[model samples]
Target chain A: MEKKNTQQEIEEEIKSKGKDNIIKKIFSWILKNVKFLLIPASRLEELSIRQIEYEKKISKRKFIRRMKSTLTIFGMLLIFFIVTIAVFAPWFSPYTFDVLVGIAPGNYDPPSPAHLLGQGRLGRDILGRIIYGARASLTIALPSILFSLIFGVIFGVIAGFYGGWADSIIMRIMDILLAFPGLILAMVFIAMWGQHMEYIMLAYGIIGVPYYSRLIRSSVVQSRDLPYVQAAKVTGAGNWRIMFKHILPNCIQPVIISFTFDIGGIILSLAGLAFLGFSDPQLIEWGNDIADARLHLYEAPWGAFWPGFMILLAVLGFMLLGDGLRDALDPRLRNIYGAKKKKRKKGKKEENDSYEKK
Target chain B: MTLIEEKTEDSDRDPEVILSVRNLRTYYPVLGGLFRRKIAEVKAVDGVTFNLYNKETLGLVGESGCGKTTIGNTILNLVSAKSGEIYYKGVRIDNNFTNDLRKKIQMVFQDPDASLNPRWKIVNIIGEPLRILERMKKTREIRKRVLELLETVSMKMEHLDRYPHEFSGGQKQRIIIARALACNPEIIILDEPTSALDVSVQAQILNLLKDLQRKFNLSLLFITHDLSVVQHVADRIAVMYLGKFVETGTIEEVFYNPTHPYTRALLSARPTFDPTTKTSRVILEGDVPSPINPPSGCPFHPRCPKYLEQGKSMACSEDVPKKIHLGGEHYIWCNQTK
Candidate 1:
């Protein structure tokens, strides 16, 4: 009875403390942590305010970090502009593909006042075709890229997570898909079925499957044995929840790296497919421009040069951005982070030595 | 006491046995060769059984692979219980109870590193049960409750927005506790919650767990191989060997008067603070017998010191001893218990 009395006394003391006090305590903790953030503390936190701030402040690769901000701005602008132009294609364009504005092929029009990129073999203005083609090119590039990435990630996760027969079967399927090169398989696929965006998208997307699926699968397989995944299972989370939630997040490093790099590759593949006479006329694509300019290579070099320059800029821009992302997103790979660690260690050693001397 | 407090405590205080597991078995099948031929079953959890009261802490102790973790997993229906009936609150653990029972019973994993979803914010992790439990449409109330749970675990309200990797092991465990407490669960299975932390942090976490149990009137199934840790917090201690519980009783009962030889041997293995005192080391002959082909009869027979004379003259392999209850809820499964 006496023992019970003391327990109740202590319990009552805690209970009587108003709810306002509890909330106040919570608010004070938040304020203190935010202050800790301003000073720029350790690599990891005992706890954090949010993952974004944690990932942002904590994740820094010197060259990658330096380049990422600029690259992101450029990449986003390019993408955002492309998407905007594509969406408002009718309004944005000076003329559509059907509009017959300027020049005949035999006229051999120079950089004249009326026609900007001169005239192409088919007696169509070069500038008009390029502008009109933006919408069609985006249709092939955007959907193919997205669809491929999604398929690869899913396939990789499933293959990696479930090993043994499932793994062997899925891996073999990937191997077969990889057996035929992207261009060859795309040619084979497009030949049987006529050239359309869906076939081109499906072809490009299928090629990216093995890359992402393997990358994601390996990460998932490695992370499957981690303590956190086991904990989730023990905590009553179903298998699917654990796979998509606990395991997927840890394995995102590979996906992010592959995403940027593959965007450029997908664009190149679409261009290659178009170069091989697989694209539609109304598509208004750069590849189609280059293709049409093949016969006029000797007469007007600018006919080939203009379309080729745009292709080079687009592919090269994405490639540089991909390199920036790969470096910035991974802290361990950055040389700048090593210097920072060394500096911190030296300072800590100096402090310890001075204290010991005293 | 207030109405809800008085009501919950009143019901929990009654010594109503909630679960009575009988002869539980879980053996993982091992396959070998290029063709993946069946080899043998790793008897991770051989026959094991125990009774659990509504409001009590049952500490399960055993070496790694001895099936303490497997038992907890099996009880929670994480792994299939191959052959056994696990009654939960007088209802058998099955597909329905396994699903619906999650609201009443929860688990805290050993590794803080992996238990939580790294992508999910703490608020989402804690409030998941609240959303899934029923057609409850009180998001704000649930958030408030999650905040309260964080406070209960001595974490700040701001932690609600953070991910799992942001915290240290101790802090992560606290977040896990907050999540477990969200459903207002009656029982929480703690799978070595302190084993993954440093020695200094272990005490703080253990104290927090004890405090939480008292405050919430919760029953806990604490699985750990550390006998001393179990001794400190457990009301009842069950000693397992080769996937079977050989001895069980109140902490005082088991420590003061151990019946099974394995239990006595386990107690001797615990490192004492006094370096000078040589508590005879229990160097068990040979490594633990492979679970794939465990010795016939009592799984403990190959290692039991008193199996020759004290036990039955009949083949020690032939007869596996059954559990016999002594007075005051003390139970032992050894033939030597007689």
Candidate 2:
């Protein structure tokens, strides 16, 4: 009767409060009732599972913090600088990329105070062209990669989730696309359609679809039979709902990681396409600048060097960031870097102690 | 007053039969060798038949691979039935593709952890069926119902915001139970609901289930290999062997006086708590035969104690035994009957 009375009293008290207050009271009550003395076995198991999750989250944060590798940092800075220069192109460059503004003829000049990266054969400012070229490279890479990702993920998830004739037919089509070398296929696409920014991006995105689709397909296949997927089906969730809601979230991590690296690869491919004269001649692009300076490669080395250097820097930055992301994302691999850092810290502490003793 | 006694007023009164299954067979093609050809068919649930009364828990007890879970899933239409007739409230729903059956019947899986979506909050997890089937559109209405369900399973309303991983196995099961009850289901198929839980937690969940069953007046199809777990809760028990029901009866009829040799063997295998009473455990010789190629005559004849005792009679090996009724709902499938 006393137990019943107290319970009734608590319920009445809880009811008196608003919903938020009731939630607070309930939380407090639970915290009070969690018996530490007699820890249940299931509770212990739950604690360990929670512990593993907590450790994973903490390790992930720590991994991300420690992921600032020298090359990754350098790459990030380079990308950041390039993007900044691209955004403020007019302010950063002294002269327009197309206009001949140099004091020398043949439009090619050696290094001077008035012009920073010397001058191209066309007399267009090399530094200005490179700054403006960053815009073209980034615009082509980011949007095309996003386009490919969206299409790839959709096709792959659908194909993998609904395996059978769908799987075989879709995979065979992708295989046909994959059979052609990426650059060669891009060239073929350029030939069929007139070479333009849109055409190049479409060609690049089309070729990229096969690779991402295959990656996402394998992941979807693995996660498709995970018990939660079956649970969702049992709950009467539609096939599309199950594919998007249940399976996609679980299988997208590795795909996202690979996507970063693919960005760098896409940038390189775009540059190659531009170098092959696929882009508009009026556009101030890195590969086009490099191609323009090719005739004067021996006469003035500075013309080719600047644009080529920028391309290398951009690619290296993207690749390094991708590598760092890979190391940071996976806990097991992250631990290797973590262990080395911890060892270095320990060694430094030991040296400090010896110095104090001396 | 105790919840059990409070509800026992109508214990003797016969409840209406809510769901019935007749000769349900679920088979899977066993592909083998390099070419992935269909070598043979494994009859997982071969011709199993039973009736579940309203507010009654019919325990389907069996060995590991004896098709108890398969039977439950087949009834729920999770696995396509090879052949059978299933009636829910007298409607022939043999091959149902609609959501009406899902609304009527909800199932709780064996593994609580696996059964729940790890990424989803308790509200969405439990509210999914309500929104999908019941069309409970308003968030306020859904929240109210979800809270009521949580309370029904002895969980707090605050638990609504939490994920499945945040709770213990017992608590996760309570959430699953809450989800099962969200639709106000007529029948809840518990597929080894307590097998994955701790022994103490198992008792709590069982008690919770019993209370919920009585409160909602819902029928239960409890599937489990562990006989003792169902012994207390089930009004009637069915013992299965090699994809077939060897024996079935009321709890007392099955527990106290099991007629089938397989049932007797199963009963003996259940460890006793009493030190005083002695029971020579019925150790049946040889492993349970594969379901792909079940014995020609009686499935249990090869491992039957009576068959060996009666000098391996030709009747035991050559002829199939019809169900022999030993008075008042107690039926056994065997050649020799006392």
Best by TM-score: 2
True contacts kept of each: 0.43, 0.37
Could you give candidate 2's per-residue lDDT for residues B1-338 as a string of tens digits?
A: 11011221122333476887777889988998876788999979887777888889999999999898888778877779998778787777877657888887888889998888776778889999988888989999999999999988877765676667657799899998898888888899998999999999999999999998889888999999888888978999999999888888999999999778899899998988997898978989999999999887788898999998878888778776667778887878777755
Docking class of 1: incorrect
* Candidate lDDT values, in order: 0.72, 0.79
Q: Chain B vs. true chain B: TM-score for each candidate?
A: 0.89, 0.93
Docking class of 2: acceptable
TM-score list, all predictions: 0.77, 0.79
True contacts kept of 1: 0.43
Model 1 residue A50 CA deviation in Å = 15
Which ten residues in a row are the worst by lDDT in model 2 chain A?
A48-57
> What would the per-residue lDDT of candidate 1 be over residues B1-338, giving only the tens digit for each residue?
01011111222233576666666888888999778888888888887767777678999998988999888888877778778667776667744455468877788888887777765677878877776663346878878888998889887765676566656788898888888887788888889988999988899889998998899888899999888889988999999888777888999999888877888888888888999998877666667898888877677887777775465445556567656667675778765544
Worst 10-residue stretch by lDDT in candidate 2 chain B? Answer: B1-10
Give the TM-score (vs. native) of candidate 2.
0.79
